[model samples]
Target: MTGRRVRVAVTGMGVKCPAGNDPEDVFRRVLHARPTAAVVPGLAEAGLPVRFACTVPEFDLAPYIGRREARQIDRATALLLCAADDAVAGAGGAVRGPGHRAGVHIGTGIGGLPGMEEVVYGHGERPMGMPVHTVPKSMANSPACRLAMRYGLRGSCMTYATACASGTNAIGEAARRIRDGELDVALTGGVDAAVTKVIVSGFARMRALSVRNEAPELASRPFDADRDGFVMGEGAAVLVLERWDLARRRGARIYGEVAGYATTCDGAHAVAPDPQGAMAAECMRLAIADARLTPAGIGHINAHGTSTVLNDLAEAVAVERCFGPQSPPVTAVKGVTGHLIGGSGAVEALVALLCAARGVVPPVATTASTPDVGALDVVLGAPRQVARRPVLSNSFGFGGQNACLVLRPAP
Candidate 1:
């Protein structure tokens, strides 16, 4: 175990998503085909183009964080802290390891834009004075710093800003460190609170946001013919990754094992995916190879189906090429959660683990049929029961960032 690649165990997970607050609740919503997309409160008043968003409900932050500290941080950072706290609680109240050997890595594409907006425009009729703590709250790396300082983690810490792939890459990189014996444990995931007016308007200008202002719930229809674009969403998810041997020795409840991870850049486009999806296909191939599992061994794939036509189609092509005609059953959580930006990948990874744990593949949660070019067995209508096997979760972001993770049932 000292010299070889150490097995990494997912000892704990915490989530604050539109689907639900905890992992089991989220899974139940997915299995029962509940959708969370709806109109965002402030966007319509601001005259934004796309008003709907998958917003996290009023989760009790007081239980996990102090009131004064909460006010000083942005919503995105607060979500990260809460998720981390839940991860520890999920791991039987504490992460077992020396503080010096544990690390934290959280991903966020943009931080505190909503807070910045509030400072400039105020929450009322009058513009408010800028808060002195604005810089700390808005920094992309704030979550990572807060986690480290609060948890007394002395190991490597980082915050990835790879657009939408940030969370996937963060978890993947943390797994790498544990597998490489650089650290014994790591808390890694993604967080983003991008449901602000300015953010939505900006994406609207790029034609990247869904404009089904009339029907909020139907806006994020991934892989559907009627799908226009993704709905904005805000949420966070964090996982505690421990070296498998250490987890076993401590008798920790093992949720699953991160067996493989691989990331690649499209290098072809800034705002769009490679029309051919060659790089994405290769990214999946490499992840499977890294897991030492054949493509056929993968039981399910949690797709990065943004519901945007171009992305869903490109990802489908990549899936077909990598898994061939007999591709695994695929599902997209974005149908329910919309696009969580950096948080999308991490939260979807959690869904992947839940699939393995429950021995079922959650349905697509969208009413539309899969497009012909991207036609694969997309689980829809109802959840499909299946034997637990390695699950592959994909995250593709703007600027061509692609990440894939292979999660295996705890052996």
Candidate 2:
């Protein structure tokens, strides 16, 4: 790991998403474009205009950690801990080799809004008397702090909160550190458990939520004619990253290599992407160049198709501009997973790695008729078997934050 072209291997991945609880299950659902959005419990009675969201069902944290321990942490932290456990276990156990050389990186857009809401609203009347663990639970750095404590990682424990781009930035930064020889291993990803009424009400008030209460499953139809808005989702995804040479020496099961990562900002809008997509396309170009590969080397794209008109269209224009008319096959996992906000990028990166491992492209879950945004190839109906090549995943967040990563099959 000497030059800027140092390779970072994705040895293992662990994901808890709306599509499924495990990586394999999630990939299967992704390939077929299965919809997972459903009415959130109590959302209908809560009087919020938006009623549906993609919620993880009854995640049992018992096997991963004790009940008492789970009670102390936030739901976002709990999800990250579970995903990290799976990731570490998949990579052949805990940090037995040079814990000081390892690190933790996680991203969350809203941190522990669910916990804060419960503490504030559940036990009313006493606004001043909050729980002692409130700050610990609600802070954005809790996941990273808890992960570092859990695995004894002493190097660079950090958290990025760039809205939906948080996860992508976390993974990118981790890969960059390892590539630059700052660390040998990093447990990096993102998580968000912000499906609370406080969170839901805010989005609903902004009118950014879908009002398809009767048809929750069809609410998140990205790149579709009838698409209204994105469906909020909750989940976590963590990837085990190591130096490519080290991974090979250890005989770790390498899924793919984090070949390149780049981030840019539109600097034009607070919540909407640039209609021209110049900045987004430039970000993609920079990521491709960082990988030391041309755009022709890419075989597929995991897009940030959040089902919203602004995001979907802007992303489409960007993809088309970057790769020209014959763009690589593109798929939006959000149609099924909904928009996981901070967790979306890591999960999409996992999807890209899985595609490289399996050589199959997933479909854009809910779009029966593709929107007339651009001519880029949008995988639909069913999964496409591809001749394994490099894949690029994109994530754009509010405040004009944009991040892109290029992933190549492990050599």
Candidate 3:
């Protein structure tokens, strides 16, 4: 299967987000420029420092998930399961092929924190006082394994843990497998339910949190001059990537084609983005080249805008250096969704794919006006309708991990 142009295409997608628990709903909300992040319920009463999060409100996954399965799988994994179910459903149920031809690749920032905390409280300092489900729930790959097992996917199954880039890494890796003929189809995404106090306190300790108790909904202001650190978010997004030939053979609807992917390491700082943005620029360059296209061909960019001061600044520099002046339309969804961390990239994938398919660029639902920092056509205030071309989705994570993927409307 090596060097054999496997023709990767996006067949389906599902998302559980503040705007909506379903992809259509999320698309509609984003298209209309709605804000979802708010003061998380119960956080104020708990006396926590940070107050806002992009919480999934009134999500009844029971309608989509089984009861027995719901009881054991961690909420993080459960979120992935629910999203994967939606994607597979969008693909018209399962593929009519060998189960081994399908695969699962999941990413999670902090897997099973809810269940692990439960175990810690339920069992004290005694040795080996872990529940049977503890190990499975705590494993970062638990969602990937469970998705593969449930779907009977025997093809390559794996998970990535590259912090914020985890989900993007999973999606990129899945596309790689499809491109290499390792699998005909794959379900890949990222999930996180790690809005725990520990996670919050840790970020707060680093002073990387938006202390906007007054206006929680307006806390996440990506690319805004007055932006603070990112607000934590929770949810999951899954996508079905199928070989274009197989999708055509099955008469499947294609959302977009994954044209290229690139992943790189900064090797500079463990927690901070490079001031020069060299690694980030190189990453985008590599992805654009991998797609066999020049940066001039890209029409839109779904940036890894986490709302942090350094991140937005560095990312803007990278995009400018890579695309030059009069760059593509860029919209940073984290302004509205907050920073979902690991799941951010996959959710951004949903936005980018839709941009490529529908020929419309969603607006940046920011609290304040977007800063005029770079040479980008930053979409704001209103959605833009234009001919959608290749869209680049960027993801940069902790430990200086950078990834970019180019997707185009499936022809």
Q: Where is the poorest 10-residue window by lDDT in model 3?
A: 367-376
TM-score leaderboard ranking: 2, 1, 3
Q: Estimate each model's TM-score.
A: 0.96, 0.97, 0.95
> Which lDDT value does model 2 have at 326?
88
Alpha-carbon local distance difference test for all models: 0.87, 0.87, 0.83
Misplaced by over 4 Å in model 2 are 1-4
Give lDDT for model 1: 0.87
Model 2 / residue 236 / CA error / Å: 0.2
Residue 346, model 2: Cα distance from true site in angstroms: 0.7
Q: Please identify which of the two predictions, 2 or 3, would achieve the higher lDDT against the true structure.
A: 2
Please provide, for model 3 over 11-54, each residue's C-alpha lDDT reduced to its tens digit, 9 standing for 90 to 100: 89988877788888888887776778777656666678986678
Instruction: Report the lDDT of model 1 for residue 122.
Output: 63
| Model 3 TM-score relative to the real fold | 0.95
Q: Please name the candidate that would achieve the greatest TM-score relative to the true structure.
A: 2
Clashing residue pairs in candidate 2 are none
lDDT of 1 by residue, 1-411 (tens): 134678999999999989889988888887776779887778888888887899897877888889889877888888888988889888873455588799998888876677777777763454345677878987778888898888899899899998899999999999999988889989999999988877888899999988999888888877787888998888999999998988888889999999999999999889799978999999999999999888998989999989898998899899998999877888899988889998999999998998977789988776567755455788888888888898999999999999999999875
lDDT of 2 by residue, 1-411 (tens): 234456798988888888888898888888877799998767877888887899875777789988777767988898888888898899884356688779988888888778888987856788668777788877889989998988889999999999999999999999999988888999999999888788988887777778899999889988887888899998999999998888888888989899989999999888889988989999999999989889999989999989888888899899988999888998888999888989999999999888976789887887887757768788888889998889999999988999999999876
Clashing pairs in 1: none
